[model samples]
Target chain A: MLSLDHARTILDVVLKTGTEKGFKPLAAVVLDARGAMKAFAAQDGTSLKRGEIARGKADGALAMGLGSRAIAKMAAERPAFVAAATHAVGGSLVPVPGGVLILQGGEVVGAVGVSGDLSDNDEICAVAGIEAAGLKADTGA
Target chain B: MLSLDHARTILDVVLKTGTEKGFKPLAAVVLDARGAMKAFAAQDGTSLKRGEIARGKADGALAMGLGSRAIAKMAAERPAFVAAATHAVGGSLVPVPGGVLILQGGEVVGAVGVSGDLSDNDEICAVAGIEAAGLKADTGA
Candidate 1:
């Protein structure tokens, strides 16, 4: 189980890295394995809808059981399937980088998603945050 | 048709009432008649997902043309109907108290939803806020 404390820790590290790197105001979300929101926040200057975007990224990865990078690749190769999958998840799937599954002992525990900067930069922050929490980040890279 | 100012006023009053009454930390939202969010705030100590629940309450009311209190009653008396209705609304319809319609001159202008305590107490704060904004609160009771 991904505890709330772990989620909070991941969120804090992601936000801290974003601020330090001077990225656009970022939104981060942590979702437990059950796909329930564990923690989420958008920096004060973030755009209005970024929080939902962050959530979408995390949920998409979980729904497909792959990192968002993999989902993005799949979407590019199969747009129709990806579109249908998005609706199947209540439109909570954003096929983009920054959604990385959290792993412990090679088992999925949860996911962390970040949004605001370039997709690649967002993924970097997510990976860093997961590592900071002493967990492995499977970005499907 | 409520403006952002009206939404903010309703949100403020709801939080104030909840705090003064010693209820749990609350999340409140205001949605205009078009069902677009105008304002929202969640107290610091609110648990995860309360913000979404608050939004669901207001959105459910606006979608069904009835306050959430009435929706809860319907959900109990006709579980199958309520289940279908929930799917029709994209699963945002949380059949519970705390969603109240904002009425002015007998016209529904918007809605307020509060969550974070007992459902009954949540409803009270929502009602107090709508009335404080000089609009009538129709809880559909």
Candidate 2:
């Protein structure tokens, strides 16, 4: 089980890491493997839609059973396929980086997603927070 | 301003209120006026889709500028329109009673949504939590 404590830690560290790195205000979401929101928080000044984008990134990863980085590549290579998958997943898929799977002993227990800055920067912060929380981040590299 | 503090209070109280009232495990979402999730929490046993339902209720309220209660009425009276509206809002609107607007001095600052038990019961807990936070709950009655 991906305990809520882990989710909270991920959210806290995601924000802290983003702030320390001077990234833009970020919105973070943590989802258990079942795709339920374990925890979510958005910085005070995040755009209203950033939270949805952040969630989409995470949800997309879970929907395809791949890190959103992989989804990003698939999106670039197969736009039509990605579009169909997004529709199939209830429109919660945002093909992009910054969405990483949380793996424990090679099993995905959950995922973390962050959005606010450039996609690569967002992915970096997400990885930092996941590693800080003592979990392996699978960015699909 | 519907600060994060207030959002946390609402989520906390909503869960507390539901448990005290002997309701089922609950999921709650507090969204700022711009439709950003300020805070969200779901009890450990909640169904995987509860968070989405909670968010849909609150988002529906904001999408129509009316409490989910009023939207419910409209939904019943105008199914096609509501269906189109739901699609228009990016499939985020759930027309139900558990979605209430958080008002301060007659201005809508945010919304609180709860789900677990019956719809009316969910609305009660949401209203209780909103009022407990020293805000107003507009059910659009």
Candidate 3:
């Protein structure tokens, strides 16, 4: 179980990355081992819609134990999973760029997903967050 | 702009109160000065159902600049505004406990909304979070 400290560290790093990269990210969510929110922050100039999308992406990553980019790929390959998950979650699960899983020792311990920037930028921020914190990043197979 | 620091402070205080008072809270959300989510946390044992409810309350408070409790009251007294807002937000504007407007210097800066526990308890948590942060709680006119 990753501690709250880890989650905070990741978020701080991600926010800095966003600042340095000129990414106007909206919300970043850190989930603990239990897939529950430990910390969250939204940058100024981000739309409310962005926050919801970020949360949804984060939730999807945590639920699937993979980065959202990978999930997006899988969804492309297998539309059935996406449809089933969307229906199962009542329209909450979304495989998008803002989602990234945090792996520890080849096992996913938690996830940090972000939103507001472009999908690629969102993915970049999350990846940078994990790397900046010395945590393993699950780039997906 | 209310920082995530203040939002997290409110969340921490509310969670502490819930633990001390043995309240089974579902979830709590704190919005920033721009009515965006600054922080969100769900208790370990809170039901998932309460998450939506809590989020709805926060959204309503932020969108309307009033406590969700007051929103409910107004909806009863002025159904037209309630209907219009509800329709405008696409069924997202739910007025209930787990939401309160955050005020600083007699002006609304943000809002905190909670769901889970009883309706009264949910409202108490929002109020408690605001008071715990040394901020004023709007009781609605």
Best by TM-score: 2
State every prediction's TM-score relative to the real structure.
0.60, 0.82, 0.72
Model 3 ranges off by over 4 Å = A1-26, A31-39, A44-48, A59-65, A71-98, A102-110, A116-137, B75-85
What fraction of the reference interface contacts is present in each model, in order?
0.00, 0.64, 0.48
lDDT of 1 by residue, A22-123 (tens): 898787888877776665656655666777788889999999999999999999999999999999879999999999999988889989888999999999
For candidate 3, write residues B84-110 as lDDT tens digits. 998898676777655788888878888
Candidate 2, pairs of clashing residues: none
Reference-based lDDT, residue A74, model 1: 95
Q: Residue A46 deviation, candidate 3, in Å? A: 3.9
The number of residue pairs in model 1 that clash at the backbone is 0
> Which tens-of-lDDT digit does each residue in A46-89 have in candidate 2?
88789999999999988888999999999999999999999988
Off by over 4 Å in 2: A73-91, B71-93
What are the clashing pairs of model 3?
A: B98-B113, B98-B114, B99-B113, B102-B110
The 10-residue segment of model 1 chain A with minimum total lDDT is A39-48
Estimate, for each residue in B91-121, the C-alpha lDDT of model 1 and write its tens digit: 8888899899999888998888888999999
Between candidates 1 and 3, name the one with more favorable lDDT: 1
Native-referenced Cα lDDT, model 2: 0.89
> How are the candidates ranked when ordered by TM-score, highest leading?
2, 3, 1
TM-score (chain B only), all candidates: 0.97, 0.98, 0.88
Better of 1 and 2 by lDDT: 2
For model 2, how does the per-residue alpha-carbon lDDT over B53-139 read when each residue is reduced to its tens digit?
988999999889999999999999999999999999899998989999999998899998888889999999999989989999997
